[model samples]
Target: MAVVFDRPSLWQRVRPHLRGFDWLLLLAMLMLAGLGLLAMYSSGYDHGTRFVDHGRNMVIAAGIMVVVAQVPPRRLMQLAVPVYVLGVALLVAVALFGISKKGAQRWINLGVVIQPSELLKIATPLMLAWWFHRREGQTRAFDFAVAFGLLALPVGLIMKQPDLGTAMLVLAAGLAVIFFAGLPWKLVLPPVLIAVVGVVLILAFEPQLCADGADWVVLHEYQRQRVCTLLDPTRDPLGKGFHILQGMIAIGSGGLWGKGFMQGTQTHLEFIPERTTDFIFAAFSEEFGLVGNLAIIAGFVFLVLRSLMIAADGPTLFARLLAASLATIFFTYAFVNMGMVSGILPVVGVPLPFISYGGTAMVTLGLALGMLMSIAKEKRLIQS
Candidate 1:
């Protein structure tokens, strides 16, 4: 008689790993992606292949997310410095010999046009999270100062490129990490208060501050115009105001239940500018109405909340900060896109996450979400 032993099959061996997956987050992402596909199809009807391309991008992003989730947080922290250095080097390269498109030199020609700022959106937060993680429990005010310096270097370079949208995203992501790392309120409040006061002053004396030939001290002429347009789009009705006006009109017309999917007059009539990109929110609002808007908002809320919960349960300080920061990135994208489309914020070219048709943004988002998944999985593995 011979004793025989059977080895476990591949599926059986891999099944344990599958148990660590976060289904809730996966569901929320799928819901948002589905809604995005619907919106892109409607908004990009006349734009040849946009709907298909958007789907392709989503698939690619999902694949990136899956691949990234497999890399544990420790490995991610190890790569953080290298990634940050590469991103900054690319930004410097862009400054010196970057490709210029539409009056903005924000991309580098590496056989393909690549936006370096996009890389920093994830890398900056990762670097900060890793930095604070190394100094966990012994962090001082001086450490925070060093972190801010780290944050400022890349942010300043991106701002010089004059890509306000990408700059704002990176700034928000870095600030989220700083805030989660427990930066004192005294340090945080002053800048926020100053920003509020500045906004009030700008609105109070819009006619003067925005008057012709008035040079805004820190903002470029176009940036100043965007702020002024946000305050009063009607001032430049046929010029800088057109996009805001059309967006507001589309949103207002959506009413309660939406005009019905693919039935938006503003969208189909081509009145909404950048329907496949920055202003896609208007097209969505017009067709989906208030109900649809609420649904999409709910999806984003779930995603953010889930990520925050993951951050709260993260096993390491780095994981916590990184997860929270990534969550804020998603919230910032949604809020800015919606606010700008509704004429309440400046038109900074921020695209609605998932819904907007953009390759770089989609890839960045996928990476952030993947990192969140990695943190979540790490926590799960520890608990098990």
Candidate 2:
């Protein structure tokens, strides 16, 4: 007797067993991390200790990414409430007993001094995801209002701490969750339009009103000054506007091709402020030039697009929302950094993801990537 057998396709055999697998997400993350190390090598090449610190942070962030990737999306949702509640509690504690630095009280003492706001950077999205998951298939207009409330609670506290930059980031991350929850354009567009108009009104008439110092509504004096300074950076070349002016000069100096790595006069001469932090892009642009900038942008675009694909293919609502929010965070970090560097946006102290030398931001980014990995893993499993 002759028997006929059909062979299974590769996807059919592999699809069902991807519980903790996400190679594409992993690859994209590693690529960004590699770029980060290259940038850091140049940015901190002169400072031995900083170079070492950057390496250590990279290791730590990698560890976080691994641990987060192993956990399933269901587990992440289970922890969301407690983490977010504790995060809020810490923010309140920060208000009462936080360490003051750079004119803001935004840190707390644990076994080691740490910023609770950084923890909320991850928790905010987690909580929002959990909330939407609970209300799935029955969302109302008021549901979004409630989601905004969840966002505003932490954001309001952070802003009260007068940490405008962090507050904005937290806001963006939480809003990402809402956007991924399938928020209506009617709900989304109005707030964004109002925000734009409000900003324009503030900028168009800030100087005249602020000159008299007669109780202007909203925005602290320093915050207002930052916005005005962005409009005309050279107005106070050696004062409040110096950072923006220097950043633009450094970026422009690179021309078509950079002066060459470690050969950037602006970076090596220390004309660029916060070269290892907020303005690190200027250091990078000065060294690598426009061609290098395009490469970095392409990498970001690829990473974000890959994330969106994972979200689209995710099996569960929770996984989809988490992946999308993580992608949005990537976009937000790049947008804020480039905008501030180019003087189109006010200097809000947002770190360039991966490139900036900061433990908190790197860890937050790692966790975000891990969430995407979880989503991708689930999608793979579902396909199987």
Candidate 3:
């Protein structure tokens, strides 16, 4: 009886899970993570435990990514609705009594302090993809309305919290899903044209619009200040413009070849504010310079392009839309962070994916990467 039994080897059992894992996607992520550690060590050396904490957070995010990757994309569709509902409920709770830090009420403490807006960054796309999935092949204008309605709720709540950065992220993810779900170009171009015109108007009337006590009827006072600061950081060099001014200095000082690893004067002199977090891109640019910046950008491009390819080949419309939206999330994070640091855009609460120091942002990115891997794996498994 003992001789009659045959057992599968451990490799045989684990091999199935490994079969379709995307090595190229993993290579891109690892490359970015390596740069993040390098940048964090240089910029956060003097800051108490920031470097150590950043490494620990990366490990945690990797663990999350591995765990999430095990779940099939089909399972994600089942979760889309409930996860979104839970996210919205938590947002409402935060609105009622969330923790406020530096005048932003974006966190809530259940047991451990948490930010609900982060959940919507992923959930909005998931919900939207799910909506379009249900309505696929029978799509209509009304269906798009329902999709936008789903998107607007959380965006409005996040804006009410005045967390423009997170709101922008959520909005971008949702819109990406809707756009991929076959939104018409006719509906898209008007808003695009309007925003272009508005930016031009603001620049043309900068003096009158930015004058002290100028009333921008729609924009909040701080929002107006951010716009004006982007236009001219010199307006209040030692005041409201300090952060942007410092960022530009750090970026420009890096030049062709960076100052040298851990030898950035702008970074070490404490001129670059938020050097470990939001503005880590500037710190990285200071030490690594243009060449290094190009490498970092190349990594992101690889990740995004690979993600979109996976989306294009997805077996289901849900998978396609979800993957595409998540892909856009990466692009938006990088674009917005780099734009703000280079003084091309107003500063926002966005992080530069793996290159930024933040446990929450890192984990969110990890979750997204895992989902993409799952979708990629699902396609391969089907072929096999």
Provide the TM-score for each candidate, comma-separated.
0.96, 0.91, 0.97
The lDDT of each candidate is 0.94, 0.84, 0.92
| Candidate 2's TM-score | 0.91
Off by over 4 Å in 3: 1-13
Q: Against the correct fold, how does model 1 do in TM-score?
A: 0.96
- Cα-based lDDT at residue 168, candidate 1: 95
Better of 1 and 2 by lDDT: 1
Q: What would the per-residue lDDT of candidate 1 be over residues 1-384, giving only the tens digit for each residue?
A: 999999999999878656677899998999999999999999998899999999999999988998899999999999999999999999999999998988899999898888999999999999999999999999899999999999999999999988999899999999999998989999999999999999889878989998999998889999999999988899989999999999999999999999998999999999999999999999999999999999899999999999999999999999999999999999999999999999898999999989999998899988988898899899988987
If ranked by TM-score, best first, what sequence of candidates would result?
A: 3, 1, 2
Error of 1 at 328 (Å): 0.7
The RMSD (Cα, Å) of candidate 1 is: 1.8
lDDT of 2 at 243: 97
Superposed model 1: Cα runs more than 4 Å off: 1-17
lDDT of 1: 0.94
lDDT of 2 at 21: 62
